[model samples]
Target chain A: MSKSLSYSSITKKIVLSLAGLFLISFLVVHLLINMLILFDDNRELFNAAAHFMATNPLIQVFQYVLFFGFILHIVLGLIIQIQNWLARPVRYNRKGYSELSYFSKFMIHTGAIIFIFLIIHFANFFVIAKFGHIDPITYDSGNTYEDLGLLIIKLFEDGIYVIFYVISILLLGFHLDHGFQSAFQSLGINHSRYTPFIKTFGTLFSAVITLGFISIPLVIYFF
Target chain B: MDLTLKIWRQPSTDEKGKFVDYQVQDISADASFLEMLDVLNEQLVVNDEDPVAFDHDCREGICGACSLYINGRPHGPDKGITTCQMHMRRFKDGETIVIEPWRAKPFPVIKDLMVDRTAFDEIIRAGGYISVGTGGMPDANAIPIPKRDADIAMDAASCIGCGACVAACKNASAMLFVAAKVSQFAMLPQGKVEARERVQNMVSKMDELGFGNCSNTYACEAECPKEISVSHIARMNREFFSSKLISEKEK
Candidate 1:
């Protein structure tokens, strides 16, 4: 073998796809757990869910893995984009048209916005809940939980923040729209029998995850 | 019909290039894109000026020798056709056509609208072939390949190694071209003996040559004169992974 196949572009893509899929799975769990906020009128269910997520031993370990996945995906993505830019040093002066999908061309753009959103998200909720301060509430039965539900609702009360949150989530949807099926493609999982279905499923997944996350803030602020 | 041609004018590989405007009048709409260029060159030569440089052969489009980025497209504003197959009728009178060479790090512009695609030949040399033993001709029916697999292989075999896929790709990735070459062999039983090694070697060469990674944009498929599908890329990915796994196990 003249070269190590492990470091080839295909292998790099495979690693990227695996990490992206892992992050996607984490998104589902995060969205479902956050959905509890919508139905928790008494403010107990959402706080309980947050407490369980913070306290669960298995989840604690998985959270670290999830963090690693995000770092790997973001770093690898930037590296690929930079390499791609270098590949074509001179660009065409006249822009052309094809049947190419618009979202496919703008993944790096969408990903950058999502990265900024993540920083804000971590500072507003994760940092405060994890290391900073949040008032703890105690039930009559002697169970005490952080008042995360109130914190989230209070954050959503700001119209500007809510708008920014909604826009970022929408861009996340744009990212996922291409990424959901793209991950499978990178893994070489394409098939004539399953590809159409996977494409449809990817679009639906993007919409649901985007709307699901967006609904939380909108609902909290409105009613 | 009259047209304004803004063609790249580079004297040599190392020199800077720019689009130089030329005019051609009373051109037939039925003239092929290359023929229009031929007319422009003729006028330039008659005026004791340097003719515009480009690549063309087998004017029928099967040779994969002609390449041009015309009017912001790899092969003019046509679908499933090479630049040689593109007709002037596709453009209206007085249209401005921008023609440039394929731009990629591995494919440097040798001159105006002529890029050195020797990198592709280098990749082919790496492992784009299967070894065969010299012996008496075997019966055609000796190997029974599934009809579907054979058809797909035939589809993949149609790729002419043109760099349009690279020219059309946003990342300048050669995944489609490499995938088509890999699939043409991977689908046939006769080539299966070296399938694992072939994919690994070709991909390694491609990466070494500085081609970008596939972003799954499908622009390559859309612009391929052969219309090679991106599914072949998936198969190449599968082959690369399995090769790694099998090699690891053997060690």
Candidate 2:
């Protein structure tokens, strides 16, 4: 009923795919910065990266863009799904087996899990870092910053949170399994000569992201 | 083959429908699925009962008229074939086959196994054709179409406008149908002239009719009688986006 609903579904899909791809790029940056924690046992390097992310003017602006991207992706995805459900008012008694990809069929379910994970992540880390009080550590030269690295380490040390985080990351992998190349397909970037490669890379990318993020919590908990 | 059958029976579009059980004896395996249904109808007529109503035309598969969700799949279990072309041999003796009409908001069932597919005609009327001035016939080779492009265009053109894609889609999206139409035109020089307007107009009409968005399940492609590629869908997306970008309506 909204003005946006008047736009063609293809237009909505274009917007959704573009927003999703932006968020995918953001995840790459976030994971790389978060990966700093594992390499440096002292936590100095991780804290410095976190400090730069919080204080840098460019990244500060990008933070708002990232938030907007996440909101747009969530809203449009739900809108599309709702419209789709409405399209089929009557349900079939049984569905025949086809070669439909399992992950593609369940994107919304996987996305819902990922969204819940994000909410918990934001509440525990983002809210505390931005709005709530977190104890700060000062360098020898008096450059003071929030000890986000230590906060992360402490949080991951909790067995339950670590387990939840790993499971959530795994679901994120499922979401990405369809989402990565689907973004390209929606954008009309599919090509017979290159689609196979893009699909292969997408699967590899999903695996890497899943393993990389899962390694963070697992390592923090066990080692 | 002796078989048990479960067929949907609806008195009218406004009336509630239900699955009605039927039995057929000694049907020939060589008979087409529609022919088997004809046998059942003959028995119904002999018993003074209402015959099962369904849609079929040019029972040889070229006509996209036949539509029935057999067991669960559109156009029955065999891949890349419509209901009219489906033979009874695909089912084992004594198997119970379930048949239902296509279910979608735009495609309402008029009666048992016969949904009004006029929605498709509506989409076609939107922008499915190219304008050609009345004159002498143009030479076939005048356009100088590349072989690869010609092949792909022919592939796109083969779409029978069957609603199987809609029935197969979880979302009941008509993207594959619209995409096939748009792609067929967009690939050729004659079609290229109106490609921008064609995609935009067709997509707008599709949305107005309340078809769902494509979720990329590829079920539509797998179930398509013509085996239409989803890549045409991607092409339609690209066409729609590029057209909207520079659309005069935006001004």
Q: What's the lDDT for residue A39 in model 1?
A: 84
| Model 1 misplacement above 4 A | A1-6, A140-142, B248-251
The DockQ-based CAPRI class assigned to model 1 is medium
Per-residue lDDT over A1-223 for candidate 2, one digit per residue giving the tens place of the 0 to 100 score: 6886777788888899899889888889889999999997767778888989988999999999999999999989999999999999888877756746678877889889889989999999999988988788887756777889998999998999988999999998888888888888899988989988988898999899899999998998888
* For candidate 2, the TM-score of chain A alone relative to the native chain A: 0.95
Candidate 1 Cα deviation (angstroms), residue A32: 0.9
Question: Against the correct fold, how does model 1 do in TM-score?
Answer: 0.97
Give candidate 2 regions above 4 Å deviation: A138-144, B247-251
Pairs of colliding residues, candidate 2: none
Pairs in steric clash, model 1: none
